[model samples]
Target chain A: MSTPLLSQGTPPVVRKKISDPLPVRILLIGLTLLFFIGFVFLPLGLVFAQAFQKGWDFYLEAIREPYTIEAVKLTLTTVAIVVPLNAFFGVTAAWAITKFSFPGKAALKTLLDLPFAVSPVIAGLIFVLLLGSRTPFGSWLGEQGIKIIFSTPGIIIATLFVTFPFVARELIPLMEAQGRDEEEAALTLGAKGWQIFGKITLPNIRWGLLYGMILCSARAIGEFGAVSVVSGHIRGQTNTIPLHVEILYSEYNFTASFAVASLLVFLALTTVIVKAVMENRFQKNSSQH
Target chain B: MGIELQNITKKFTDYTALDNISLNIASGELIALLGPSGCGKTTLLRIIAGLESADSGKIILEGKDTTNLPPREKNVGFVFQHYALFRRLNVYENVAFGLKVLPRSKRPSKSEIKDRVEHLLKLVQMEWALKRYPSQLSGGQRQRVALARALAVNPRVLLLDEPFSALDAKVRQELRRWLRKLHDEIHVTSIFVTHDQEEALELADRIVVINKGKIEQQGTPQEVYDHPANAFVYNFLGNVNVFHGRVHEGMVTLGGHSVDAPDELKNSAEKTSQTFVRPHEIGISKIRSEGNDLEGTIREIRLLGGQIGLNIECEGFDQPIDAEIPRELYLNLQLKKGDRVFVTFNKVKVFACDYEI
Candidate 1:
């Protein structure tokens, strides 16, 4: 047998990346980093800097204000209530869309996404028009001793409208990707509807649900335009955190406004971090589970 | 008693997936629904398992009408093609899912459930990977766990939908053998769907061939293979050489050659008929023998492992006839392409021209 000596015959070859050339890759990466720095980091850093500009005492005083605490409580309450409601709605909607084939399914999916495309202000207007005191349904509800407008319910409703699609939209594609075969298997194994859902469906969609919940919470907490529309700006009564922050800024209390804004920034940052951690777990769970 | 599907018809919009399909499965018999893709074999199995609703029919299990019953009430173990093990659950948990899902009044105790799951896992020979999640396991392992999961319920009948079709070829063969052995030990009436003729022929005690929402034939594997009911069954069961010819003078003529027709075809109204013969049934000779049926020249010789395949081109035949010869015979003959040979068909199935494959 003759030895080929292939290594000696061939010259060293330089591997070239066709997907992205060196200059283009570097330029694209640099531009992305610069965009995040200038828009995200700068704004976030400025909020904290300006909040503490008046020193720790002023920042503490602003946070300790009774109205500030009220707004914080209201935002938390809205998130606590809205997140679960929307999550439930999202799960049922996603389940219906993925599990069954029915007429008008596509239309139902489209309608679920309507709130997403509508401006936050328009969402608030839609709710207000349907539920306000001047409307028949609103008056009927008022006759039943319910207050929807200029109240916590109204603010919560607006926030819910704005954040509703986050959970369902994220979950639908995930549920669809994870087909109904497992559920069918469970059912044929003598599993009831609830058992199949809890044992098979819920475990498969937990990470997606949690991711959607965090995002929904963040959106609900940070909702400004819609809440501002229906809140009526009642200082400690109807004002959510975002509306309260606007009130503080308009009153020239920049430090107080930024201090309130800094809370939202922390929440957004935490959401991103949680999403990053959850994303890795999500992929791992989906692949290995 | 086993299962009896009475006129089970299912339609998806205008497309009839199962057109009044009726079947009788014997107790403790392992059967297979064999057909090509979209041939309603899977639909038949799903209908029997209560995973799919039939438009109009009766599903009788153990002599009781189970029509319109939901899957939860069916008491049947269904293994899907994709395995469909709970992705989040470990192998042990997945196998135990059926036992756990049983009503609390009827559910086995925890220790009993554990013992059952372990026994089933061992039955499928997947006990070593009990703690591994489905995604962490290979396709073959997942299917084993899926089988164990289905058996966990101890249902009267077991239904599998192309249980090993998703696996690679080698794994699919191994699993088919494993499934046959498992069915033997359990003695549970089992029905599985498959498009592979070998899998159905090897694993099934009875083969039900479905086509276009109807049962084409149902009998022992050998029965369907040796004497296929129609052109579809003849072609779908295995490789067969189709000879399209005319019926004249009590014989079917191919090119310039002729063979005696079947008893029923005497003076048949049909002007044309197709004669089907298996590859191995055709005898090859270097010269024209006394009972030779056709004169042909070898177009191609293929080495098919222990058997040698020859594609013989004959006059007036659109496609070359495939003849399989034993390796020993092929070696002794030293046959090559373009060799003149006479073929003697030992057995032939004659069908109407309209039923040509």
Candidate 2:
């Protein structure tokens, strides 16, 4: 089925559809777009309306307060740390998983994607098992003055666990399809391994990497379940923006909660915009190919 | 530089791709390792270039054994059939990649690298395409850029594996001639692997014929064409017409007709043999009670661009004899399917069929 445009001489471009019957295809697309608007855009509009009910005074006062400012700082800092480190880990893991032939390769790939399949709560528990003060390694590290649990590190670890596969998963199939031919060509041309990665492999995969990083940062910043389990939600000490929103909600401060949540909603929207831009760049590269 | 291989072999589990092959190539020579698919010609080229490690062999380049050396250590330029140009790099960057990667002390200066790359690009007549990415160039142009990039390294030897097999027929023919001219001008010891006999005959200084993971013959193109060492070489090199015959009473009996045998075979013992002659060498004419003639009926006729092929069925020969005649000569004959004709076998070479024919 296709959407046919009326024509005078030459027929207009007809958009193709996987289904039969033009009316049914149009109905299906209309329903999907309606669903997006109702479910996604409606709730977002509701949150924005709530944030501005008392005018810009409430929004500005909520954002300028020291605790709210600190929480925002902590969230941004966590994302900054998580994005680059995960990007590196992703590139390395993807390169190893795709290029080198070895035993246990399939098992390694499945393990790398474990966090994506497992619950965020269980991911948080994994860090607790390894780093909580109750365990021997944890207590020993605590004696050396390392405080992981109920601190910023704990939140970062939980975010890292849940967001581990984003960049690497994005890069593996891209690198695999691109093949090692260009890398081999560069190597033969006297480029070292790092030089090849920089000049050929990196540029080829930069768009996918950026998209993955944006998604990772979005999930890292907006994370609640995993970070909640690890952070202990101490006010003004280890509270992230999401935890701050939860704190305000528990105290029945609906306006403050919605205000902070709206801020994060804006951050997430920026992440989405970054993703859209990266995807557009990737599409241009693919069309050129 | 000269290349010599001794007892070179490569095996993959149950299949042996190359077996105990040895050859000596002179300096500044363009040798074509000509063979059918899976004949191990590319494997031999890779072994010599150090891209592949031979299971058992000694690769002596410039009088020094380099069998264990890696490709980078050997300083050999290799052009893959796919070209393998860096898609992200413009033509200039791709050409300068090798020089820029050398150690700081050994690396060429910026201007030197630029000049060398420019010079090589001009050599391949690709200077105008320098600012363009590989994706913007056509397949033939990309191959030319690949060749220029390879030459910029000033390799000790150049190895190309079916370099022109990816192009159209016309482009392939043009590139074949261009590569030959490039080789002559540069005077680099180069070895190329190809399955095209015409390219091998026209471009290579020496053609090494390989079949079934073994060398069938290695010689000048004329030597292999006019004096093939065996039946396989004769049939592989060109279209040959074969006839079963026996030496009896000091006379060669073919199709129940007698002809004088070559002098050396006159006094020899009677032996059964397979006599093979190229289609272009044998003469075909209409049967008019001609002297030393074998009667046959033309079964099929094919008109090629410059030549014509006739398939003739004769008694005592189950398979039809194929004759390739020039178009100019074809005009003088009224040969067609179902027409009776006499095929005159000229001085044909005979090989004994004692063990296997």
Candidate 3:
């Protein structure tokens, strides 16, 4: 409601507006839109369009192929194994770094960021060098009849390396900011270490953990370079969705390649939607505090 | 329970947080560890609570050695400065957390826990917030819940770390009174750390002044306030005006006036000394009543609710001298800025210049 005295007694004062001029504002917005369309939206749209160029029957047939089905299963299995292991590692690493003081703390922090800094292909190669059948440890493992490189385990390891920092990076700052106050309070109240972590620390960082898991799973599903190096292109056995797409494309199977690529695009879109929802919930929860 | 610390010391890298110190706190006594930031007051409280370990010391609680006990085994309730309530749990669950975390054999039944939580919440006057999360509550309310949660385990001693510092001025005052009342009702051996001298004075039965990892003094609030042990304690407890003067026989000459020095300094050799006087200990007059009174012009006048504070500029003193008098007395004197007035020291404390703060 307007104040009657101010409305009747005086004219509104002119205030200096803080904004860019019209043309500059329009130009910046126009450039951002053009970049998004060219670099992001168009490629995503082209995947689905090209996948369905022939017909629904052809698209369905390509998706139903044995190799394609096996690729989907392998991808799901990789995510299923990688995400939980990484999540466990993330929570433990975050808890150790944030809650305790130890020698080489700075070095440990730098090592955590190693996954993000090193190339995924190089990570795959490092594992190969250490675990390949030619090395002493690899030959020892070979004597034990356990194959790691160029197998499902190798694919899992590569994905684990690349997505290692997600959950930990998300939770380190969150837990650090939350501090050890609550845990100390719990301990003073006669709660054990696990009780404090389960009843206090876990719940406090739940949203952040979920957010990191989602990002990890998304990367695990669509990982290309590292998984490619380790999988050995063993058709239905070792080929994941991205690797399968590459194989199909290089073999001149255009329709099948696009169809498989479209699935990844769909998965990426779903991840984006879930991430947006999680972000909204996280903001709401944090703002309430 | 009673707490005793023998030769407690703590260090962080090169900085010593708590020097070798010893103290005894009687059961059911409300003690305030008062100090400036980084003076090791919080460290002492944490050590007693078993949240921190002294480098070499023995902690005796209720006549039992508890130096190596973990916080869980120490049976001390701690309320953090920020409240530290579980962000995800509602008030009821937060209060029930301690009891719920007890061993299965020792834990109370469901109905018993519910009754206890409800009673504790009511004790803190937060029963109506049973279903509300900590995020929905005010700072004072969160602190109340934190206290309730701490009390759920029925600890023998309660430790509060700057409990009221996070709240606003009005809320801090209100909660200070509330905490005092609660301590009276429960009669638990409670120790709270605070940097606010007024809070310490108003809430603690006894105040222990700490500075640079050493105990300066410990006494009842009135005793410490009236008779400080040293220069640091004198300057910390309240605002005071300092007079740089010399003690030559039994009298100390300050500006143009001379007053009898303290007995300890009076018998010492002739040397430079510093005289300390609280704001309310100085008197102002329109005319020089005593032959030893010093004259100065009022440089600033500040009305402090029930009292009037005047900053007087004397000829020899580099800094203006502060004097506070009753509002009624100010009205009678009709004092204002630029008025020339005579000032007299009502009560003075003398310390040798070598004892620097």
| Best candidate according to lDDT | 3
Q: Which stretches of candidate 1 lie over 4 Å from their true place?
A: A1-18, A143-145, B291-293, B354-357
Candidate 1, A5: how far from true, in Å? 42
Scored by lDDT, model 3 comes in at: 0.91
Off by over 4 Å in 3: A1-21, B355-357
* Ordered list by DockQ, greatest first: 3, 1, 2
lDDT of 1 by residue, B297-355 (tens): 99998988899999999877788889999999898888998999888888888887764
User: In model 2 chain A, which range of ten residues has the least summed lDDT?
Assistant: A1-10
What CAPRI class is candidate 2? acceptable
Order of candidate numbers by TM-score, starting with the best: 3, 1, 2
TM-score for candidate 2, please give it. Answer: 0.87
lDDT (tens digit, per residue) of candidate 3 on A198-278: 899998899999999999999999999888888899999999999999999999989889998999999999999999999
Against the true structure, whose TM-score is highest? 3
Between candidates 1 and 3, which one is better according to DockQ?
3
For model 1, residues A21-96, the per-residue Cα lDDT tens digits are 8899999999999999999899889999999999999988998999999999999999999999999999999999
Candidate 2 per-residue C-alpha lDDT over B282-351 given as tens digits, one digit per residue, 9 for 90 to 100: 7888755577688889899998779898888887776788888888777888666898988887768876
Model 1 scores what on Cα lDDT?
0.87
Please tell me what DockQ candidate 3 reaches: 0.43
Local distance difference test, each candidate? 0.87, 0.85, 0.91
Query: CA RMSD for every model?
Result: 5.7, 6.6, 5.2
